[model samples]
Every structure is written in structure tokens, then in C-alpha cells.
Target chain A: MLSDLYIPGASALHRMRPAWKLALLFLYCTALFVVSHSLMLGLGLLLIALGYGIAGLRPRHAFDAVRPALYVLVIIFAAQLWLEDLAMAAFVTLRLIALLMAAALVTYTTKASEFTDGILALLSRAPKWLPKDKIALAISLVWRFIPMIRDQFEEVREAQRARGIERSLLALVAPLVVRVLKSADEIAEAIEARSLD
Target chain B: MTTRDIVLIALFAALTAVMAVFPPVTLPLLPVPITAQSLGIMLAGGILGAKRGALSIILLLVLVAIGLPLLSGGRGGLSVFFGPTAGFLAGWVAAAFTIGWMTEKFWDGLSFVSATLICVAGGIVVMYALGIPGISLMADVPLSKAFMGSVTFIPGDIVKALIAAAVMVTVKKSYPIIGQAA
Candidate 1:
């Protein structure tokens, strides 16, 4: 859903290690929490965008990535307008967009396997008494499951539409729930077969 | 737990624990501040699905319920459950369920990015619904006010959702087998 905004390409940004990218991503996000403003944040956002461009992404691709979350951007904009002033709200909204875009740029270029491995490497740094393998497995599993959910959602939607149940949350939510439960079993079996146990 | 397993679990706990302690934010307009905790929820739900995700939260909540101050403000205890953010806190389970189910059902085509969107949609929407109402009732504020306060989170939440969804999609695109969601 969110990742589609990625400009499909290879570049220096894309070639960076996932661990390094994630660290940069984290630090960049943290910077947003601190002071987000005209030059600093704008420049930050711009650099990130430039990185995306250098990675061969077009304007349309960036738009596509943030398009899904547009509603959220609007809502937050509204909240800012309501709670504070138009200026503050606008500033915050722009800052957020920039930060998320930067983050997405990193995601857009990085490979999933490396991303998962990067997270696992991060997890392995924990003190004694933590389930590093499970955490890594969980991260990998979630990443793997994304496409499955999208595919199932379309199938269920089509199935429901065919059944003439238009816009029923049940039609959507129920199958989703069932499919998830079933997947769990399949995953466990796979894991067992692989002897991850 | 075996020595290695113990080491691994600690690692997982540490990630979440560190996140809990970081306490980053976008704004202070609302009393119930927005933190990266939702990202934690997304990660937990996206990665662990139901049982494991639920377990991760429970482990964190246990520390909170026992007065470990494991929440955003370093404030925790059973009392925290009754506070304004409780609904959002409690929403973690349902959110996980929603993400897990969505990812499980459609694990083949949607991509980890899209699955992340599902996870975040359920996680945040349900979280706020619960959090707002819980906060209203607990703080003696009008429900509408509580709802308004939550407005500040919409943009960030949406961004989080998109990121989660996008990441999921990308992953699924690469390793097709990772789709077993729930």
C-alpha cells in the first residue's frame, strides 16, 4: 500500500546497506521530533527527495507513495488548523510529509531480505533472555504476509461483490480473519518442517 | 529458556523497551501525545500477527501493570490502564488481530507494504476509538473533546499506516513464501 510510491530503480541510495539506511531513517525521524522548520527540515526533506530522484524515481512515484495516506495528511492538517493556527498546522504537515517521504525513499530503494536481516541484526544486539530468532522470524513473516493480505483482500472483495453483499464490513473482515487463522497453521507447519522449532 | 533463546528474547524485549523509552513526538496539541509506540504496535502486529504480537504487548504491559513505568512517559501501572491512553493501549490486541488476519489472508500478492497498511488501519483506528472513549470517561472530558484531541494524530498515523503497508508489500514481492499471515 505505502511502498508502491517507490520509484523502481537502482542508485547509490538503493545500494546502501539496509542497516545503514535504517539508522539514517531513524535518526532522520528523530530529528523531525525535535526541530522541524524552514531550512533544516525543508533541506532535510529535499535531500531525501533528491536521494529518491537520484535513485531514478519520478515526481509521480513520490506522489503515489504518499497518495494512500493523503486522507491522514488532510486530517492532521485540519487538526493543526483547529488546535493551533494555519501557519503552525501547515508547517507541521509539511514537515511530516517530508520526513515520511524521506523514510519511504529509503524503503523504496532497499531490498526486503536485507531489510529483514538488518532488523534481525538490530534484534541480536539485545541483552540475554530475548527471542531474537522469533523476532526476526516475526519481522520476516509480516513482510512476507503483506502481499498475501492484498491478494486475499481482492479475492474476498470480488467474492463478496459476486455474492451481492456490497460494502459489508463482515464480508471483508470475516474472510480476512479466517484467512489469517488458516495462514497461522500453514506457517507453523512450515516452520516445524524447517525445524525452526 | 535456553541460553541462546534467552539472549534472543532479551533482544526483542530490548527493541520494544528502547522504543518505549525514547518518547519521540510530533506535537503537544493533544494531552495524549503521539509517540513511536504505534510504530511498535505496527511492528508487533506486522511481524508477530496474533499470538506472538499479543504476547509481545502482554510482556510490555505486564511491566506497566506492575508499575514498571514502561509507557511513553515512563509512567505505568494498573492505573495507567485507566488513564486516557488506555483504549489505545488495549487496542493493540485488536489491531494485531486485524493486521495478522489481513496479512495471513492475502499473503501472496499484496506486498508487505499493503499488509502494513491493513495492520496500521486496524491498529490505529481501533486504538483511537478505544483510546478516545477511554480517555473521555476517565478524564471526565466530553467525548467530542477527546475525539478532537486525537485529530492531531491522523496525519502521522496515516503515514505510519502507509509505511507499514508499503514495507509489507515490498517484502511479499520478494520472498513469496513469507505470506502466511495470522
Candidate 2:
């Protein structure tokens, strides 16, 4: 998810340390929480957009950040409108948008290595028994699978469509289960082969 | 650290950080926002086992502690624990331990369903236990009222549990015996 953007060349926004960038992100979010005024939240949202532009992220990338949650936000806005007022709705949505882009820009630019090293550096205070290597392996698994899961999701859909059983939960989910088991077996066997012991 | 190890750790941490930022589902009845982040927590436990899972989460929380806007709604920083979600945040550590312990406790063999249940309990129930007290104190509502409000999250929690189960199965199939040791 962090490496999806194709924007060429590193810019200053991308160059900011992940640690400092995270600090700014917190400040911006806190500002969003404090700025109850819609006009002001709107300004914050615009500022986040400017940050995105500075990071050299395309407008489409920003849309990609909010697109999945777009419908959900609409429902949330409608409910907030019913329970609260229009201004509150506007404020809430702006809060959501600003936070999303600001975070997206961070993930969009910061390399995963920076994130891990940043973490290892941070965790130096922990007890000596903690196995940092095992933790690193697990993190690698998760990172390795982000795109893999999405790809499998599509592959499942395509296979279902071909099988003419796109409508059934049994059909849709069964393959996912089967594939999962198959993958687990393969992973286990691979571990056995390497015989790290 | 090996180059490969660095890549792996970074990837999982990023996966979790992304999940943490994932927007919560808004149900009409509940004031609390639900998200898929908890499942990520469970997955951290199941796939990484306890030590690694805990470490990955520690890394994520460390980012938050240091003031990264990595939480849901783009909220982060040490101050957030003072907010409504602090309990859930703290629960991540406990939940990871529970998941790892349960998944590895099979003396007979790998009982995927049993492991899944244990992980789910850690992921859902333990979190609620921690989170409710947290919301009770932070929101300053009666414990029961705080609980009643959070009960709305059960439906979402169940979904997260099921998804965690599915993902656990995936891990078993694709990457069984996650580390070098069988």
C-alpha cells in the first residue's frame, strides 16, 4: 500500500523524516479536532491537499484514498445531519478527508525500510528477551501479502465469474478458503525445506 | 539485522499502520466507529506468533506514542489514549499475547479452528474488556451505559472475528509454520 504511487523523483515532502512527518500528522489531526468551524476544517482539508500536491501525489491518488470510504461517509454524513446539524456534518467530513490525505501522503512517500528502522530504533528500550527477528519476519509476511490479498480477491472474482456462480456466498467464499488452506500448506512445507535449524 | 528481515518487519508494520488508519464502519446506532484494524491485530498474532506479533504492534504503537497520525480518523499521539479509543489501543498488546499463546498451544497438532477461536477471543473479548473500562473512564459515563454503547460494536466485532478466521486459514495454507522453526 505504501508503494503504489508512481510519481517520479523524490521531492522535499517525500524527503521529510518519517518521524517528523508523523509529528506533523499528529499536529494536523489535533488541529482538525480543535477547528470545529466548517470553514476552518475546510481550510485544513485544503492544506492537506496542498501537502499531497507537495509530495507530488497526483489528484487521482487523493481520490483513491477517499473513494472506498466515499459511500460510507455519505451515510455517516446523513446520520450526523439527522442527529446534529449541517455544520457538524461538514466538520466531520472535512475531518475525515484531511486525516485521510495527510496519512496517505505519509504512506505514499515514506519507504517501508524507514518505517521499520524507525520502529527498531524506537524499541531499544524493550526487554532483552524480545525476539526482534521473529517480529521482523511477521511484519514481512503482512507486507508481502497486502497486494497479494487484493490480487487473490480479483482472481477469485474472475474465477467465480467464469464458473457462472458469482451470486452465491458458497461459491465466492469456498475458493477463498480452499486457496487459504493451500497457501498455508505450501508455506509450512517451504519452512520445512529451508530447515533453518 | 539481515536485509530480508528489515523488509519483512517494515512490511507488516506498514500493513498494520494502514489498517489502523482504515476508516471505521459507521453504524447508525453506535457512536463508536468500527474498522478492520482489529483483524490486523489478530493476524499479527496468528501469523507472526506472539513475540513477533507483539513487537510489530509495539512498533505501531510506538509510532502513535511518538505522535504519528496513524490511528483511525487520522488521530494519533499519546494524548489519544486520553480519548475514547485508548483502551482498545492498549488492548492490542494483550490481544497479541493471547493470540500467540493459543495458536501455539496445540499439543496434538495444528487445530486451525481452535487456534482461530482463541485468537478471536483475544482479538474481540479481551479488547472489549479493556476498551469498555477505557471508554467508561474517558467518556465519564456509567460503566453499564458505556458498555451498552459499545455493545453495538458486537456485530462489527463478529465480522472481524470471522474475517480473522478466514485469514488464519489462509496463513495456515499459504505460510504454515511462519518462521524458520516448524
Candidate 3:
């Protein structure tokens, strides 16, 4: 569930280089803060909607991008209303929505590998002790292990549940950590055997 | 770092992400849901020691920056770096480092009480030192108001600290790894 975020598309946004898309996203977010007017933010939302459409994504995609942030946005909205005025509340909320949508659009279109490569390229100019290759390996390993660990957690939870254990943090985590560490040992040995380092 | 160290770091980073999969405990008054992911921060530092523990969190944040949706509620991307939570995100790295440092310092006679204190120092104290100001700046609220609002998270975070201390002690006895690793 980690890196399968790229939705298949043949649109211009999809075809654009990952680095450029990321840069533009950065610029858009910076500009969102610089321009405080709600009208401009509304226009920015329209542009993001147009972006989703141009990328052949549906309205649902835009909604999905903003949905995770709805709670925080609501809280901010309420806080702003209490602290300031109704207009300020709407402005702050709209600004965050615009930022989330623009950023989500890039992730929806860019492949994980392409994104990683783009990041690595950006880091290529860093000092030598950084160990770029090792960092890359670590990233790939993280991607590989996220789902595996999720599965392990579920399995452990199920086993514990069968034993009439429920909602015990130590009971759940103790076994999960042990199993995960055990697998980490095996993975390390495998990497050593292959001399992947 | 050794292969084992690298793998341990990656595995812990994965653990942190998996922690986010659990449903957050929400309070009606507060906007942020209390999530399990921060417990992973304490565990990493307590288990992996200072260097590798901090590296693992930095690695996770890097992935988040590139838009993996690894955070709770599937929120990620460059935008998160600019969000109200950005300071807490930065604090995670520092917190892990602090916890690891304290754990290693007390490894010779590490107790549950000491471990819990370490988690509280790093996870709650250090985290809020950065996070409160972040909320203050991003939400355009005063520092005092931000600090007042953040009081709700402390009890939950203390619970996390206690749980992390227990897990750390168990792991240390069952499969010691902090100083054992190359």
C-alpha cells in the first residue's frame, strides 16, 4: 500500500518530468501563502480542478486528495472563526485545500520510481559521506517492508485475539516487534550473502 | 552502517508507517487525532540507539516529502512540510535521537521507569517544544493559545511513553540490539 499511488494516465501532467512537477508544486504552495486573498485562493482551487481534469482524473480524485485533511481544515476553520472572522476562516481553509490538491495531483501522476529517482538526482550534489546508494537501498527496503509489517501486525493481532487478548498494547507489540526483528536479521543475512552493499 | 543496521532502520521505519494504519483516537475538542506512530519514534530510539534511530526517522520523512502518503490519514507530499504539523514532523527526528541517546546512556542499568522517563522527555517534551510553535506560526495563533490547546495531547502521549517503555524493556531483555549491533 506504499508506492502504488501512481494512477495510470497519459495526460500532460503525467508526462511532465517529476522534478518539474515537484518544483511547480513547491512554487504553487509558496504562492498560496504569499497571496492571502480568498478570491485568489478560490481561483487557485479552480486551477487545481482544471489540473485534475487535464490529467484525466475525475472529481473524485480531487475530493479524495482533500478528504484526509477535512478534519484539520475544519478545526482550523473553527479556530479562525473564533479567533478572527468568518471570512478569515474560509480563507485559511481554502488555502489548505488548494495546497493539498496541488500536491496530491503530482503524486497521483508520478510513478514512485520516477519520484525517487528525481529526489536522488536532487541529492546528487550533496557531500560524499552521504552514501546515496545506501540511502536508496534503505528507501527500497522501507517500501518493501511496509506491507510486510502490516501483514505481520494483522497476523499477530489475529493470533492474540484468538487467545482472548484485546487492546493490550504490550501484548500486541511484543510479538510484532520480535517477529519483525527476526525477519530483519534474515534480510540482513541475505543482503550480506549477496554483497549488495 | 552494517547491513543489519540498515535493515533494522528500514524495518523500524516500516513499523512507524504501520503504526499509522491504526485508527486515530479523536477528541471532539481537538483537531489532531492521537495516533500510534509517535510510539514508533520512541521504540526506534530505545531499540536502535541514537544514530540509526534518527536515521530511520529521517528516511521516513524523506519518503513522506516525496509523497508516499505514509502518514496517518494518508496525508503526505511536499505540502506536509508546509502544514501546521511540520514542526512535529521535524521534532520526530530530534525526539528519536534524544531517546536513543538517553537509552544508550542508561543501557547498563536500564529500568522501565528510566525508559518511560526517556520517552516522556523526548516524545512529549521535545516534540511539543517544536510542535507548539509550529501550530502557532501556521495557524496564526499566539504561542500561549497553541500551548493551551496542545495540553489535550499530553495524557495520550504519556500513555504512549509507558507502552514504549514496556516494549523497549522487553525487547532489550529478549533480543538486545542497541549496542549489540555493529
Best lDDT among the predictions, by candidate number: 3
Instruction: Give one digit per residue, the lDDT tens place, for model 1 in B29-136.
Output: 543345555655665556545545555565555434433434554444333443235577777766766666666666656655566568666877777767778655
Predicted candidate 1 versus true structure: per-residue lDDT over A1-197, tens digit per residue: 31221235668887888667766866776676565456776777778777766889878756644554465466666766776788776776676566546655665675544544565676778876876766555444433454455566577768988999735433443344345444554666666677775
DockQ ranking, high to low:
3, 2, 1
Show where candidate 3 strays beyond 4 Å. A1-3, A120-127, B23-34
TM-score of each: 0.50, 0.53, 0.91
Error of 3 at A148 (Å): 2.4
lDDT of 2 by residue, A5-50 (tens): 2234488977878789888877877776675566777788788778
Model 3 RMSD vs true structure? 2.5
* DockQ for every prediction shown: 0.05, 0.11, 0.60
Residue B52 miss distance in model 2 (angstroms): 4.8
Per residue, candidate 3 scores C-alpha lDDT tens digits across B1-182 of: 88788999999999998888765666566555678889899998998999999999998988887768788777776667766667899899999999999999999899999999999999999999999898777777678877877787888898889989999999999988985736
TM-score of chain B of 3: 0.93
Better of 2 and 3 by lDDT: 3
Model 2 alpha-carbon drift over 4 Å, by segment: A1-6, A116-197, B1-53, B56-94, B100-120, B127-182
The lDDT values for all models are 0.56, 0.62, 0.84
